[model samples]
Target: MSGYRVGDIQLDEPVSVLPQAHIVGNIIAPRLRVAGMVYGSTAAHDTIILKDGQIWGDVHTGRLEVAAGGRVQGWVSSLDSADYQRIREEGVVPAIEPGAATAQDLPANGRSVTRSDAQNTLLRRLQDEAASALAARVELEQTFDKRLQEVAGETTARLA
Candidate 1:
């Protein structure tokens, strides 16, 4: 009517226009049926039906359907970038997350057994190994020192 007509355009029988329909700009839709006049480009996704209208611009679409008394003058292009931005903006995907798992919750296999259980097991094993190694080193050092003292005492007795 007032603004640009889009979507499906249907016509019943033979209808003629006196003044004629003038499309100042582009017309983008899935289908277009023109029986009057179009001065601008006409683009349709499925089909573009030009009955007896006079198109001034180019007609570029997926399919072009022309009747007996259809006339085109200007260039017509397909609807590619017409609704691309709207679709991209509307079709936004949100990110998903599994449950919460921290470093302390990891087991020996890096799997989550239990948070405090895994941490306690790791800490207890480390402490036990460190204590055993320290005790062995201390015993070896004491044995070496005692042997050195005995050798010194034997040398002093021999000199006397």
Candidate 2:
């Protein structure tokens, strides 16, 4: 990809992805004009998808214009009118700032979980469940083995 950034990019003005350019990350801006391909979502006050332009992720904007041959593969949701105007006037999203977000600022409902964090959390949970299941299986096997041995001993005694 030509304009692939490692993380999200925030812009104060309108941004355009040129015809030959492709971006792999999310974009945050007042407006976006795409003439190329974007692999990630976009949050902007206004978005125009030119001919041949494609977006593989969700688009969140107040106004969306798509020319012939343009395409978006994900959901498109219009932003609140007030928030759209505020971003245009302020040059930034109202609820988000340009700094590191603290834990307190992040919600607890897993909305802000990164890919790695989610993967780690899932791995740990699966491991714990697997261990518990294995322990239960072992206990069940032991109980069956002891019962079988007792039955065998009684049968032998009766025969003798």
Candidate 3:
């Protein structure tokens, strides 16, 4: 509540979300650093840091910092820092990993992939596929409901 901060910056009250914590609902607070699983959206007046966690819903905050290993399936929106007329905002900056870089950032000279790297690649692909399937299922359910309602409406009109 007190010592939780953003990099070298200090916040009045910043809540550090733990890895064991799984929130089924949204979180609206001054500052929040996510190291856990969040099933719902997260909105922070100051900042929201996604550090090695999964967020299934949108994230809205003044400042956002996503760690290299973090996963966010939803949109991330933020207001301009200059527009912050309230309390001074502090960012929960994630620690920089030594070799955290995208494929584009890597040198064109490709090195042979190691066994561990290949395993990790496969694991990430599996995780992504599962997430995609889950999202598709939700979409399919919504569409089915709408179609069912339309069919019911047409049948009622025909009977009437």
What TM-score does prediction 1 earn? 0.35
Worst 10-residue lDDT window, candidate 2: 92-101
Error of 2 at 26 (Å): 0.4
The residue ranges of model 2 lying beyond 4 angstroms of the native Cα positions read 1-6, 81-160
Separate clash counts for every candidate:
9, 0, 0
Clashing pairs in 2: none
Whole-model Cα lDDT per candidate? 0.47, 0.68, 0.56
- TM-score, cand. 3 vs. native: 0.42
lDDT of 1 by residue, 1-160 (tens): 2222322222322222323443344444445666555444444544434555555544556566666777655333333544423323443211111123555555668764444645655554554454345445545666799999999999999999
Give candidate 2's TM-score: 0.50
Best by lDDT: 2
Task: For residues 22-47, write the lDDT of model 2, one tens digit per residue.
Answer: 56667888889999877666789889
TM-score winner between candidates 1 and 2: 2
- Please give the ranking of all candidate structures by lDDT, highest first, separated by commas: 2, 3, 1
lDDT of 3 by residue, 24-135 (tens): 5455556778776655555565544466767665566777777878877655656444433232343332222223454556477753442354555565456546555654
